[model samples]
Target: MQPDSSTGLNGKGQDLKIVSLISIGQHPASGRARRAEQDGRAVELGMTLAASSSTQNLTVLHAGDSQQAALRSYAGMGLESVRVLQLRESADAVKTLSEYLHKHAPDIILTGVRAESGESSGMMPYLLGESLGWPVVSRIADIVSIKEGVAEILQALPRGQRRALTVRLPFIASVDNAAPEPRQSAFGPANRAFMEQQQCHSEPDTARNGWSIVSARKRPKRLKIVKAKTAADRFKAATAKPQGAGGKIMKNQPAAEQAQAIFDLLLEEGVLR
Candidate 1:
């Protein structure tokens, strides 16, 4: 392993260049304050990976309103500076991000699996990867290693299982929440960090909003098994079907017979042993 002085790489072999895509999330509390979304944890994971001696550089990128507070929250997590692609709220985010990435390609682009707000299709990474013609990996727990233009990744799976995958360079990844929690934001670093904004002129995608959206008073009560403690329990809950429309109404029936019917239904639904 040799260090590349020009690239600021330490004595490890792979030339690790990383970019973390960040976004604003609704605050945990009801009112004013803002936060980096749950997916922002991916950026923190990227930062941790870059902190390793093997990595060359880690850059943070965001395409959103310039004055958003979430940007500062990210900086507080120890990013020296964040690169901004200034965009309007109505701008096509996918296009804007893809355009910026195309001009300046990195070895790896990291983002959260999905955003928490506003048409959060969670398709940005996939779309960006498609635009760049690079493979996109989702639910990534960790980067095991990067060597000789190939990256070994640990993919998170259900039931606490992890799968190993090796992919060629210049790819996008959506980090899983199963990864380690991000570091807390600090006031000092956040206040000192510099922001470099670049103007973007991508057109807004109006087609997505063409469909009518309506809110109803009550949503259907989904069938869910509460307090699942095992993989089987979770699986059962996820696959469980809800009861059909209505049940037989017992009128003028014996009390003992009605009790038996109710008990039978409970057993069939697994509500009672």
Candidate 2:
């Protein structure tokens, strides 16, 4: 007998549901732009998935601390009623997030490849999946289709190649830059979302972890503040700098001559000891 295709189990057809858990922003000190890009990708992929499977239930969730950066990033996404799950800064964030997902029981959970804070651990999805006994697909570029209880995922590999994968329901996927560009948020939807707040109830602290508020006598600003009116200006400034403009390329030279030329260039540029 042919194996079940719809359910990917017993051939029984079942409805699919998707829940995207997007992280808003990194800590004040983190230097990587991956988190912001990932958040945008999550929303873009979630919107695409929702549109493709209009019949399936879809919900977008934001899981992170209440930092100013995080809140602003998520609030500006123009998402419809994001579910905010807050946890203590010193608490086990992974455990807290996992517990929430267990209760929510979404068929598919989407998160970024990693967070840019304290741990900067790209292990959230894997750890969360392990804790919840669900499969995880990292660096997922797109969701090709969702049928019955299985989803067709497109994993982005190195060198711009893609791999097709099929995973059962109740899985986690970490989005990457290979996904489509995020849409420009509509001001009307963003303004309306404030009226419909969906805040998740904070779980009680069970783990015994000491908490101490360290008050500084003279609090020194620890964050770097760059004032830019627009994101395009910021992007242009970041990638505009060019290095090694006067370097020479010596082709058809002997190996010994090439080595000497490189050493001379390094000395001329003060890059060699």
Candidate 3:
């Protein structure tokens, strides 16, 4: 039997394995547990990639407490089950997750740019990629196509731009909001979907020992530019001036002239060059 090179399937047509890493999210307003926004998108992307190959396998994996009710939200996204690597809150998930990936050797790993709770440093993909020695693509909009052993990806760029990148199989990518939206999870599946739990080696985070977290100091205000040519003008500019009809007003004039007057005033104020 020949493998599908276009879809990048193995000889058995079931070799491609995709995994979406999910984390418990906290609502900003209430600080309550909920399905993470980006993690949902990660699962969406993983499902999208799997849709290309008929026999491809997709798994939603979480490395946290399995008892959290938020895990069901991911299962609601038309998934039969969610695999949870049971770990404590203080346990560093990178080591355990990296070990799992090493053992399974999935073709692709999808994750969110940042978590909604805890430190949320947005460093999981980098750390996991470093540990696994795989290429990590950050803020990817979509995976265009997978051929042979390479997958073409559309990387999300600033200012609504996308850059095409081709990465080999067994790579990690951080899903961006620019990607397709995730489907709404149904209540039935969420309640029925089984939570497959597995005990994993928990590595305590020693770096956070005795860590002091304080509210960050506010940034200094931006310096203002004075448009006055003379020091006296600058002083007058800084000082409060008498209100009511101080500057020339263009009430009755052509639209172009009024626009030009406004433009000139803005230019004089150093607002435009």
Candidate 4:
């Protein structure tokens, strides 16, 4: 690979073994099998990291059915192959995945913040990090640069902000939705890339069997949202309810001026504080 100034490295970065974990995604509305959104972004992030460096060591991995069509959908995004560890449906994924990751010992591991199917507990990365004793960075937007033996990371924060961090080599990161969107999947590569499978030891989720799974309570209807471009428009709409006998109703005034009057009234009444 050629040297890139953006990576903050003197030359090409060392061959960084990158592994992106994928899972069978379920569409929320349709309840159909599909490629997961965040996992796809994880793969996209992995591709970006691999393309910037010297070696092509990016491996897309799954720990479930090899015959699932969703896996191919991921490969359609320019992967030559996807590695699958064959395990039964009843088996627990965390233990098997931890074992596989420990054996390979990749330099960087990428995964979605949470799975789209099943429990969706959003704890896979943390569990794996704890098991492997590797540093775990959660909800990261991007990896800004890598140099010598450290990586500069941009972690996503609340309210669309970002926090910069630097961590040493060999860490796991959970890609957030705030990261770059994934490339469109193509039919050719997806159809051509094969599922490389290997039989792995599996343990039944005996604990899960004992716990009863219940459907989550439906969310209450949300309040109607009124979008306004300006503060005056917002104030007019928000305070436009039917005027009660005790309420003051102004007339023959420009909307901007009326809004200003209301604002002043509210401010003086301690309602705008």
Q: lDDT per residue, candidate 1, 175-233, as tens digits? A: 88777888888999998999988898978779866855432234466454478899999
lDDT score, candidate 2, position 149? 55
Q: Which stretches of candidate 2 lie over 4 Å from their true place?
A: 1-15, 26-35, 53-56, 66-72, 195-273
Give the number of the best model, judged by TM-score. 4
Q: Between 3 and 4, whose lDDT is larger?
A: 4
Using lDDT as the measure, name the better of candidate 1 and candidate 2.
1
**TM-scores for every predicted model:** 0.72, 0.61, 0.76, 0.77
Better of 2 and 3 by TM-score: 3
Expressed as tens digits, the lDDT of each residue in 190-260 for candidate 2 is 55554223344454444534434332244464443556789997777666644436667879989999999
Cα misplacement distance, residue 94 of candidate 3 (Å): 0.8
- lDDT-sorted candidate list, best first: 4, 3, 1, 2
Cα lDDT tens digits for candidate 3, 1-273: 122345543223445788999999888778899999999999998887777667648989999899999999999998888999999888989999999999888888999999988778899999999999999999999988787878899999977899999988778999999989889989999999999999998989889766775533456755657699998998987885444454887778899999998898889866688
Ranking by TM-score: 4, 3, 1, 2
Candidate 4 Cα misplacement greater than 4 A, ranges: 1-11, 214-273
Tell me which of candidates 1 and 3 scores higher on TM-score.
3
Q: Which stretches of candidate 3 lie over 4 Å from their true place?
A: 1-15, 213-273
TM-score of decoy 4: 0.77
RMSD of each: 13.1, 13.0, 13.7, 12.5
